[model samples]
Target: MIDDAIRVLAGDCTVIAEDADRSEYRGRVTTIVKPDNTVLVHDIDGYQPVAWLTRADSVSSDRTGDFTLVAKKDTQTLRIAAHDQDGFAHYPTSAAGTPVGDCPDCGGALVRSSGVTCVSCGDRYGVPADATIRDDQCDCDCGLPKMRVERGLAFNVCLDRACESLDAAVKQAFDREWGCPEPDCDGDLRILRRGGLIAGCEHYPDCEVGFAVPAGVVDGECACGLPTFETGSGIRCLDATCDRALEGALETEPTADD
Candidate 1:
């Protein structure tokens, strides 16, 4: 899906456009919602649900604040915003586009001339080829990952300090399971992914467990017969050859450490 996700500077209160008829907001300038086309918002509830606004004006920490709009409909697109209130700025400020080099996506080394194909991923820039591209594999320095299998599978977790959006990851993990794994535990677990191989159980306040499901990567059919997800339990099989007694047997466990 084309994710129109944006990260604004994060602020207190924010709103987005819900429908074309913004009449309900005629005199309610405090609607806080934005127009359909979300302009740029900074230092408020950064783009999460996406609020469309026009030229935003007047920001106040006080509950009672006024904005500079000729009338409610005059700038109905404007949305009132606030920061996280956690005594910190937004994760990545939007004042200026981060430098490509400094950008986490671009990473450190932007230039690498090692091979034609991406040796690390084996993906050619445009087409698939036999030759190996050495550059971005292991930073321009770590080099391409060799075929030699390590002693144990390192946990699939990415321990990056910056990549800390764990909520969605955890939800995806639970979705992989489709529900809870513990037979006796009937309630249901909330999945939260920590960058590393293990994901945190959504029941953080209570049930704190870690898992190793690759969030959305459908591997294959579990021995049981159900389609196996990255870190899901056994597959659900109904084939005459399949067995439901032994947890269906189709469910595969983590073969490697991760």
Candidate 2:
């Protein structure tokens, strides 16, 4: 979640910025304090900000008499002192994208950015990269949108991963379903979250065989003993780099003469 944007609008402010160098200006400007604590002072000047402090370590403001804002990073500092203030307020903002649904917590409009995010409340739900967000809503109390995520199969999961975890669904569907491809290894492949989603060997320390879950639904078993996935490109083995499996799959395909 992110904090709301704070703005000082239509004000005669003096800006002093210092890092490796020092610069100062005094004019009617607008100051924007972004959610990430980055301060931007805008004047009649072109596209770029007149003075800015990017993701400052500390940001302090005093609107008692004159609206004074000071933001500092490691070695950089940006200061703004307003002589005549017009308005100061906080506004909610979110990344722009296609609308998904409403936030159950704040009743804000949820849109798909990198993930599903509420514009007003700043609530975020992480989704799988290959998952397709559906128009239908979830059946859970969270009231979040649903997504079609493909592991071994396409599953309709809640937008909020915590409410209905994609990993749990995948694990339930495919865990221990495939045998380890390693020779002389009687271990089964277990679906796990080792940094990322992967089908790893049961005997981990002894047998280091593991493959990243492909961004597709399982089609069939591969000649390499791994599962073949029907990806966007084509059918591919769980181990994407396995040329032998791909070659075997191609070789088994029936020709026009057959």
Candidate 3:
């Protein structure tokens, strides 16, 4: 979703900027107002702003066809004038572009609108805009492509429901260092619901192990080479038998240097 703090304007305008030291810069520029009301003036040739005013500064403007805007701080002031133009037009900023691929459900065009959605069947896929689809296939044997969501934060997920990797991907996204907790089981665990704290084993009917995940717990590894989680209670090993042993080792271990 587009943030409410950003305002976009396009048109021909001239800007005159003055600093506290009485230095001045004048140019024809485009303006963008941030959510915090910070004004950014941009030249036609570059992406960076040529002049700016913070939200703390006061601004005044005239609405006439030939308009004037003045922003004032302690001693600095910026004056902008609109001239020799058609008019100003506002356009919504989109981080996502045209359709990435067809919808899996009904073969409809899938485009990013808030979230990735299908234009034909109205199916909503919960993939974030920042996520990227990989060129590889999922291990689930479903021919569909796997999406690498939250590149640095999680693993790839298969969009196909017929594949088992779909469940594995959801769990890996939420749990740091997430994996199957069951002994000798290679399956992974995933959150049972979106925005919920409960996580369950993906190898259901085979490995019945599941647990209630504490809020804000980060999955990690213990000194004893076992999976661990940092909980409010403390850093405890996933295996109950190794918890006490890992706790003693952690207490005596030296912390890593920053």
Ranking the candidates on TM-score from highest down gives 2, 3, 1
After superposing candidate 1 on the true structure, give the runs of residues whose Cα lies further than 4 Å from its correct spot: 1-177, 195-200, 220-258
lDDT of 3 at 30: 71
Worst 10 residues of 1 by lDDT: 146-155
Q: Which candidate is the best by lDDT?
A: 2
Better of 2 and 3 by TM-score: 2
lDDT of each: 0.32, 0.85, 0.59
TM-score of 3: 0.39
Candidate 1 to truth, TM? 0.23
User: Who is ahead in lDDT, 1 or 3?
Assistant: 3
* Model 3 agreement with the true structure over 109-204: per-residue lDDT tens digits: 667656665566655555545456665756654444566643223556765444645445545566534577555988766567545334557777
For residues 55-85, write the lDDT of model 1, one tens digit per residue: 4343323333322222123435443433233
Which stretches of candidate 2 lie above 4 Å from their native place? Answer: 1-5, 104-107, 120-123, 140-142, 220-223, 233-235, 243-245, 253-258
lDDT of 3 at 61: 64
Lowest lDDT 10-residue stretch of candidate 3: 86-95
lDDT of 3 at 63: 61
